[model samples]
Target: MTPRPFSGFEWLIAWRYLRARRSEGGVSVMTWISLIGIALAVFALIATLAVRSGFRSEFTGVILGANAHVTVYAQTYNDEFGRPTRAIRDFDGVAERLQAVEGVTRAAPMVRGQVMLAANGRNSGVEVFGQRPADVQTIPLLAEPERARGDIARLADGVAIGQGVARELNVGVGDKVTMISPNGVQGPFGTTPRISHFEVVYIFAVGRYDIDRTRLYMPLSEAQTFFNHQDTVDEIEVLVTRPDDVAAMIAPILDATGPDYFTWTWRDSSGGFLRALEMEDNIMFVILSILVLIATMNITSGLIMLVKNKGRDVGVLRTMGLSEGSILRVFFICGASIGVAGTIIGVVAGSLFAIYIDPVFGFVNWLLGGGVWDPSVRFLSALPAELRWEDVAKAVGLSLGLSFVVTIFPARRAARLDPVEALRYE
Candidate 1:
């Protein structure tokens, strides 16, 4: 009776061939080189994908957490004096209507202005956001207790400064900060710059260098007074339950706010940057896939050499009643075994590296004596690595697919070896 495919004898023969010593003209050294090459390639692919995923997540999180998902701006229209005015007069009513919209979590009216801050004999320019105390606490990143210093409760009575601003101005919570606005009072001669003092009621670090260095939060009432807007607001900041769904919510948002108001989503604000990131991600994957392809080529070379070295064995096996399919299975198993083992090793190593990236990065930074990554330049305080199962799966599929495909050519050559010629050479 014919035996089943991949029987114990076939496995035993494959194992014996793979375990052949270098002195016996075996391809042992080449096999090891191929294995290591595939492993390193896979590891690199996985690690890079993880870092890319993590950076995108962190970047988007910062954008959505600290800022509004959508902003509503009133159209510029002629006032009683025929001068164009862009301020929203009925901001409270507008905000209330926006809050009633489905998917909208909150709508807060705000005044935004550029101002120079002076304290401790240092001066720094910053963008000041005037928001209600209650609304200020609703910010996802700032509301974190560990990320914030001092009381948010005092935001109504004082201003909340960013960590970088506090550091630059050499001021802390409860310290007085002087703000000078360019849009000051209009006098007979010209407009004089408005200067005002506010206590730093809170300090926050959102892990973004640009925002941390140039943002200041003040009470809505105080901001209105400081900016010379008695009761009007510059815009209404809207937060949604799902920021990614902001696009679909735009029509409803416009319906609620009327035709005179225009809406800007976070995607509109950062679309270019996000698109660049996505493009980079695809390019990197393609580049690294080339690397994986090059690495898998080693398996082909190793198996070709193995087939050449085992020519005499193939002749003897055929004479002993072994079929061509059996010979093919034997060499196929040899190549596939190496591929499977290497892939497993690579996956384990890459996953561990991604999962413990923080400590590993810290160690490397320590060895380099610090400053391996700059938050000011990178916009994130730490190197991020987020291992996604789908990315990992894609990598595995690519590696194994290449390995199996390359092994086929060499396995077929071994199976088709002319027993007469092989035995005559032996």
Candidate 2:
């Protein structure tokens, strides 16, 4: 007898077989294993992506807050440490020209230099930053009142110190500190290091190990005189209307300043940290995604078991002229259904878990008699879950795609079954 071609009804048969199996056996051990694997893989992918996104977002925010969106430094502008100097002089209204560029929100010249901070007989290398009093507030990471002084511009020798620097030097408000610049003065000594004293008006803590302990803030005029860089700034720190447009804004600044100036965005400045974050997320996602792959394997096994049990039906269908493609589709549909269902469940489950990780951690912290805002162990006192939609989309897509891929071989095997051989056993 000529076998019949498989039709839509054959898919119904496949589904019915799956349903019957579930009703009678209520998910075989293999099915359970597959389900667990898919669930775990989905969970891990979502969680890893969320964490990576969160950490990156948090760190980026901190960095941008402390730094500018784009920094334009002198090309030859070397420090007093005997390097070729970069010129950052009046580019004939270059700051205004940059501010006119599309996506540019604010542009300001920043004076920065290296200086030795001396307090209470202890001295440390510090980066002295000079900024406009009003514009300083616009930068991302600065805490309110960190520059507690009324106006840095008016204060001749007033300065601000980081908490870490203060603690180490045992200096505080009303204390006097002397800053020695690497740039020397050519007076009677014919090239002696320029040193100046300033009164510490306020102390601020940003909590960053690098910035908090090694930064000092002073007026631009004081810094210029201290460094002997008259009418020139080390760089121009720009604030953009949108962070993503940092690169777009850079071109104009670079063009206006000419090639002699080095223009860079925050991404350029924080590339190492960003790369590390991406690597961590990728490693975690790969590790977690394995769970899904394993689950898909289980699904494959279960479908194979179904094919063996339903050999008689398959034989009958084959005798009825079901094509190999139709047979393959039937089994593929069955296996894929299992994977799809598990992936859906996992996506929802993992997202909820990530969203509430902080609250859960808080409860645990409370139970352990630890303050939620403790600044000792964890870099951040509270838990933060930064979920990006793109990450979620990627996780779900990978899960679905893997599930589909795992079904292919099993489906092919089912399609290739010989009707006579299958029926002989039945």
Candidate 3:
């Protein structure tokens, strides 16, 4: 009687063929090579996807945590002196209106000035932001006790400096620093530079080297005085409940603040960088897919070899009333078994690596005497990994698909073996 498709006997015969001894012409060796190749490829793909996801998440989190989701700038116009001036004279009213808008969490009127900071015989140019102490406390990064040192309540008493700036200026809490601005006093000769002194009462490390290295914060009153703005603010910084929804909030925000003010979202400022990241992610996925394909090609080579070595067996089975379809299924089972096993192994390994990436990197850094990750250079304190289920599914599907597709030609060749010629040779 003809055996049912993929019956017990088919599996038995396929497994027996796979277990062929090494002395039987190295079929098992090739199987191991194919299995290892596929496993490593899947692992690499999963690990890369996890890192990409994590990096994007961390970068965006930093951007939103340390800065406003949207900034509303006053329209610049030629003054009576024909010089361009941009300031919101009704900043408090506009900010109160913006805070009343739906989805707005906080609306802070702030003064921003570019100045040179000098302390301990060291000097660095930095951007200074001036806001109320209450509003300053709303900054997520600054609110973190671990990331920020000193008192937010005393912000009006002095100033808050970034960790990198403190390091550069060799100053800390209660230390003195002088700020010099080019937009100081208008004298008969030209514009006289304005210089002011303040004590640093807080220091924050926001993880992004660029921001940490060049940011300082002062009380709004002090900043307005220093920047020569009388009862005016440079912009109104608005924070929303969901930063990702800032684009959708533009209309409501404009309606609240009136048309005299134009809004700039975080996306508008850093959109190109985020787009570049997305493009890199897609390119990386394609490259890794090619790698998985290459690894699965080994399945083709191993199956071809297995078919050649099992020719005499195929001939005998065909003579014993086994149809060509049964023969094909038998060999298909052999190749597919390796693929399934390898994929399972790879998924487990990749998931674990992503989950425990920090400790794994710690071990690696220890092995190499430390310094594997540099926050100053990478803009993150440590390597990050976020395993996504969709990425894992994609890897599994690609691996198994390539394996099955490559097995077909070899399985068909085995099924079409001429019984008469095969047994004649035997």
Candidate 4:
């Protein structure tokens, strides 16, 4: 008749009821449904997070490789307006000084100009970039693994054209192309539009249509002479050891430049894409979490039904002096057990699938005739999956929290059952 003694005994009986319910005819169906729901929901969430993270990581690499981590340009409203007015002196020494900065890995100067590329009477507007061969190869990580080539110093009057540009111009390596600049050269009579020709020594296909179609790279001297910039540059590109440190690294360089130039990071150049990815992640998390919540609600319903079916047992236990707290703990433990088992299964399934997603995508790509993850059309060259422990932990925590909270209603209802009414019920 002791209430305290009944606490331990009530839990023992509660556990038996929980285990016994699995064998009950209708209860097993509902239990399996609830378990499957939680497992599938958690699995989907984890897998989706991994793929999204992979996309961001790989695309960021492409951007970093194609451009510098940080760019220092003349501080006018725009580079075009400021190029003539601003003076960027000591550029050669600037690269060495920037290398001494804590985070900077390398620095280089580049001349940028807008010009028309003409070949065989076919013309396309392009952006020409001029860089010293040594500096060009040093800053951005541009290695043609497919070609097994080491450096791109072969780009003398040589040029690397994008796949799109090459197709449009019908040009290839060893072809001659002419660049006509709108910036005219000084003449005895007046300024005259200048035309310069360069031989394409090497070609690089970065898989970005906009970059490939509109970009052309050549030696720094040719670009300067062609653009009429005898001893000045359009911008300075700095590569950093850690991309995350780009903003912090800019402060000292900006101070060194003494406000004559403005520094920009890759994040600044590609803000729109980065923000889009962030928004997508948030949306996916919210949408997927709702599924787990819906599954938890199912668990709540199943537990409530079980409590009703076992009303007589609960009433008899109360009559035997079981405490409400003990009754509540029993039901809670039962529900939590279901959640834990489902979560374990889901975590295992999700991790395995995420780890193999890249290979799966590659296989799919081969099956689809090499078009599953087209770098030419899509930002990501292949399916990417990046598993983060933090994401997994968040999912587990969410599942557990939802599962525990859902048990409260059923647990409380069973604990508060009236023994007298329940004992009289047939």
Query: Which candidate should be chosen as best, given lDDT against the real structure?
Result: 1
Better of 3 and 4 by lDDT: 3
Worst 10 residues of 4 by lDDT: 142-151
Please list the Cα RMSD from the true structure of every candidate, rounded to 1 decimal place: 1.2, 5.6, 2.0, 4.2
Shift in Å, residue 234, candidate 1: 0.7
Query: What tens digits encode model 4's per-residue C-alpha lDDT throughout 55-89?
Result: 78767867787788898876654345553354455
Each model's backbone clash number: 0, 13, 0, 0
Candidate with maximal TM-score: 1
Ordering by TM-score: 1, 3, 4, 2
**Model 1 accuracy (lDDT, Cα):** 0.91
lDDT of each: 0.91, 0.74, 0.89, 0.77
lDDT tens per residue, model 3, 1-426: 665788999999999988897677449988998899889999999999999999998889889988889999988977667989888899989999999999999999999988999998999999999999899999888877337778878998899988989999999898999998889999999999999999999998877888888899899999989988889889999999988878999999999988778999999998789999999999999999999888888888998888888788889999998899999999999999998888888889999999999889999999999887887899777788899999999999999998888888899999999999889956
Candidate 2 accuracy as TM-score:
0.72
Kindly list the per-residue Cα lDDT of model 1 for residues 1-426, writing each as its tens digit: 677889999999999888898777588888899899889989999999999999999889999999999999999998777989899999999999999999999899999999999999999999989999999899888887237788988888899988989999998888998999888999999999999999998999988888888999999999999998899999999999989878899999999999999998999999899999999999999999999889889989988988888899999999999999999999889988888888988899889999999999999999999999998898787888899999999999999999999899999999999999999956
Model 1, residue 175: distance off in Å is 1.1
**TM values, all candidates:** 0.98, 0.72, 0.94, 0.82
Of candidate 1, the 10-residue stretch with the lowest lDDT total is 140-149
Candidate 1 residue pairs in backbone clash: none
